[model samples]
Target chain A: MSAAAAAAGLVLLAAVGACAGVVVGAAYVAFMNALRVPARLAALTYTRHMTRIYEAAMAAGAFLAAVWLVFPYTLRLAPAAAGFVGAAMGVYVGMLASALAETIGVIPVVARRTGLGTWVTRLIWFVVLGKITGSLIYWLYPPLVP
Target chain B: MPTVYLKPRDSLIVAPGEDITLGMLAEFAAEDHELERTLRGQPFLPGLTEGHGAISVSSLDLVRAIRRQRQDLDLRIVGPAHTVVKPRVRPNPVMAGIWTAAVTLLLFFGSLMAIMFFHADVDMPLVHRGVYQLVTGEAAPRPLVLQIPYSIGVGVGVLLFFNSLSRRKPSSDPSPLDVQMHIYDQDAQDYLVSQSAAAHRADQARQK
Candidate 1:
């Protein structure tokens, strides 16, 4: 690809990504709700209005996240702060991704469909391990996915 | 002595004036048919005279109420100690609508951001270009052919995956969201029951 073509492709890709982002984000939140994170948080706090607060926080957080993702920048943080941020992001992403699977009753449905009733626990461990491995590969060697 | 095995429910919704019987509050199995029938029929709470909200009842309370009538009964209480009795009332339409709208908007924006972030992170445009070039053996500045179909596919894929197309669902199967909501409801109810149980324990300790 020529230099001009590559630049144009990047721009076009950004446009497509933005559109795809909206759909994915909405679906992610919808699935997150299925996981009942907001509900559980509200119940834990013993506040009826906590759900609204949680939703608002999520919306604002997501907006900030989008901004961070789109604008290429490097932040120098203390190791502790970096660790905390990484842990928080990991938790949020993990829960959101798992929500899609759990909400759809993936384990139960897969077990029933495959007639692996006895291996339900094993299947769960497999999913967990599989996710960890895939994530490790993606982060460790991004070229694999690309 | 009748052995009554009591498994307390997490929550029960009742009408304002409805009588709450032992059977409605908990699942109890007893050896003696006559005693079981009598215990099940026993009034736990006198028809709510005034209140129209939740009233937590503990297993201890149930056992006490049962023992009041039959001192010779042996009660084995299993599961959570409390049951939250809520009034069955239709929610206000306006409030419900507002809540729904707020949630819908929030989720839409949040998910959109997440997807965009992932795309930007991976440099998806470059990926697309690579795939397009590999397939066609030509460098197209704007791969509308591949991009357009892929974009449309994303939306359709979401609809199918979520099992919802607007309001008219394509299938009778419960959507993932529906299943999650159910699970959340169950979790919330369990939390409430446990909370009530803890409160009951604290109250008893204070009384002693």
Candidate 2:
């Protein structure tokens, strides 16, 4: 790519990152609310913490799926760039998706019993998994993609 | 005792110079020194000169202090109170930079893994060969013209999809993320208020 094209590509990627941030940040609110309601109801009661663990798993799965859908585009574009710019952009997308996923899964001790907590927790792990998967796709996908 | 008339409800009177702690705020009954940490630097007490101390201000100053931190308090003094609430301080640059870097790394890893797992599930090579044949009307090789636009379109598509998620045209519509963030902020405010109320109740119970 020419210098101008490369610069434009980077700028485009940056915009993508910003948009991703907004999407993930918005999703995080739902995740936290999920955690909060359960704790409020199960207040001071002794319940198994494993329920919260399960919630975390489910949320993680959702997040992973969401990130997976959005991030593959960057890889498709990587071959267009002359230098590392394309791969860098791919990384940027990956990171953006991952970071958003990370913020969703934390289940507070009080909120552990609620379905929301599990939902949020799963959402968080999903992002983490999504990031890992995205990275692997970028590196391991055949040259046809790059 | 110089009395100051509280606004909205003129029935209320505050006499500054009386020892006032956060516990005296009618709504916030914090334990000793707790208010100092929680509402620190926000002038909750007028004439609070010393450290680890009670706020001893006249009723007018008391009203002034309340107004300083909380303009929505509906409690105002009649006289000129020179209290100017300070703006929130800027975050430390170094700390901000570190946080930004950390977040960036985390995002990178997240996407990396995301692609990996997704690719594992699908047949990307077959998909590529299919697209190549469809675009070129040839065996398995696609030209740069077709490939370039297709790649660029992917980015554009992603943007268009997310922009529409906000339910309005891009650049004009406020992002749904902003709305979600606002909800979280309101939740935090509500949480703080509830905690304070809970603390007050606990204190009252102890006294009873």
DockQ of each: 0.03, 0.06
Could you tell me the lDDT of residue A78 within candidate 1? 34
Query: What digit string (tens of lDDT, one per residue) describes model 1 on residues B67-179?
Result: 78878877899987778888766556785556445444443454444444554586755755544554455665554455544433443334333444445442545545455
Q: How many Å off is the CA of B156 in candidate 2?
A: 3.1
Best by TM-score: 1
Q: What share of the true interface contacts does each candidate keep?
A: 0.01, 0.10
**Candidate 2 residue lDDT tens string, A1-146:** 59999999999999998898668756764654443322322221334465576457547745654665565322343333312333333333333332333245222321222212222322333334434445344434446243
Single out the weakest 10-residue window by summed lDDT for candidate 2 chain B. Answer: B80-89
Please, what are the lDDT tens digits per residue for candidate 1 over residues A28-131? Answer: 67866777655544543457666777788888877765775566333443333333443444444444554555555544543334333333322333333334
lDDT: worst 10-residue window of model 1 chain B: B151-160
lDDT for each candidate structure: 0.59, 0.40
Cα deviation at B23, candidate 2, in Å, is 20
Interface RMSD of 1: 16.6
The C-alpha interface RMSD of every prediction is: 16.6, 12.4
lDDT of 2 by residue, B1-208 (tens): 2222332211112343434433244233224355434433343544332222211123454555655665644443443222221112334678555644544455446444445455445744344444344333344443343333333333332232123223444345433233344455446545544564576679889999
